[model samples]
Target: MAAENQTQVTEFLLLSFHGQPFLFILFLLIYLATLLENSAILALVSLDPHLHSPMYFFLSHLSCLDLCYSSVTVPKILANSLRPQATISYSGCLAQMFFLMWCAGTECALLALMAYDRYAAICQPLRYAHLMRRGLCVAAAASCWLWGMLDSALHTLLASRLSFCGAARLQHIFCDVPPLLRAACSDTRPSRLALHAASLFVGLSPFLTVLASYLRILLAVLRMPTATSRRKAFSTCAAHLVVVALYFVTANLNYNRSSSGAWPVVDTLVSALYCVLTPMLNPLIYSLRNQEVRGALRKVVGAQGTLRLHS
Candidate 1:
């Protein structure tokens, strides 16, 4: 195929795993549950004054990100699963990639900021108030959002320039970075280099920050005089740690595994896990594992009950 005459792809087909009715129903339920759970957390945090700490502030943003992150791709997947041939327009694919990348980068930075918040609260309780003021928290969160959007914009700009002369069938459920690069007929080394650099910035850098925060947290916990204090300190960090581990582990596994050549099932499963299941699990980890979130939830429920009774 001549470089100048190669056919430009207007759309691409997403190949899913068999597209069973049961699978579609299952994914639909999971997606709906993710939306409801994350939305509820956001609402509760917004409405409850007692939950207005830096921690819950980050949690609320985390919920919002997860809700949006899942929304960027899951509904499309659910809709696609029911179709005879799952297809997405060129613009739609680019939009999906952009939004997903933005959400992903934002969440990575947000998680690091959340870790620092925990570290400040636990390791430096006396100065926690000074360290994590409203202005600082808002600035941090805003930086995460802005940086993520910038990263996504750059990625989309580069990716949109690539030519596609071969089959337009994507071997995964969504328009992920790796598969899209693979489908490109043009040389993707520049794009791949840019992507790797972005990953290092948005992904690995934050991961290392989280690790350092946890290390400091551990040293602080070890120095505590009482077991009760140690347990309390550790408890505050446990949920975030679980989330970080799940996210980094799955993400590293998915992306670090050969970008072009791999078993499709393994790739698809890993992609689904970090992309779909992680969002669903995040709110659950926060709400179920944190007492303040539980109390806030109960208060919200109780308020609703009282309003219903009065009505």
Candidate 2:
């Protein structure tokens, strides 16, 4: 009982964008809206059969990833908004780090899968069916989880070696690797190297994959016979392109830099967009833009109303 009690770290301290009093309400609105919109998208995708496709398969997973990614930081920030002081236990911090990395890594792989799906659809329409079959979709989604798990496992291992001997305060909003390393009490060279390697493997690799896939997609789109077909394909790629750009910009800034603090607020805001709004907008951007998704949504709503009336 004593050992167990001693081992259980109670809470963690969160540093907001910058101890800002005015930002709370704005952040609250953003978090609330993101949750609402992302939730609706996920519900609609699951309920509407017509929305089932390689695109939606990827979209649904992205919705889920957004839910998770946003969840890591926002609730705590909201709580801090309501309270004057915010704190978290060591265990809670560890859990947050694990889960956040898990979701982020998964998003990396999932995005790559989405790009591949687009590549297949645009570059090889005749064989898209055989290529992106139900089994393949499931396997691709499973691979995302596996990759995330692998990332989290290695990170956790590296983090355990760190000792919390210095200032307990974490500067960032969440328990990110660099900030966490700054707080560690003991040597963290191994952990830092491990994190860098993981970044290259889990983060940079996906960016390259998406880039190559999009390059091919663009070439394929250009070769299309009709203007309408080109427009439709570009539209499909547009939202993803915007979202991916947002993620890579913020993420690369946050990670790729060795040391910099030119604009923390701007960085925080961009990070929040990738972590929060991107996830929120993914389903809406994709589903609303596509006619098939809207048709599916209508059918689902109609079916539900009919069922309720009959009942």
Native-to-model Cα distance after best TM-score fit, residue 69 in candidate 2, in Å: 1.5
Can you write out model 1's per-residue Cα lDDT over 19-113, one digit (the tens) per residue? 48887887888899999999988888888898899989998899999999989988898888778888998889999999998998899999899
The alpha-carbon deviation from the true structure for residue 151 of candidate 2, after best TM-score superposition, in angstroms, is 0.3
Q: TM-score of each candidate?
A: 0.94, 0.88
- After TM-score superposition, the amount by which residue 218's alpha carbon in candidate 2 deviates from its true location, in angstroms, is 1.1
Model 1 residue 270 CA deviation (Å) reads 1.1
lDDT of 2 at 105: 87
TM-score of 2: 0.88
Which residue pairs does candidate 2 place in steric collision? 10-89, 11-88, 11-89, 12-87, 12-88, 12-89, 163-185, 165-185
lDDT tens digits by residue: candidate 2, 259-302: 63355565466567767667666666765666776777678779
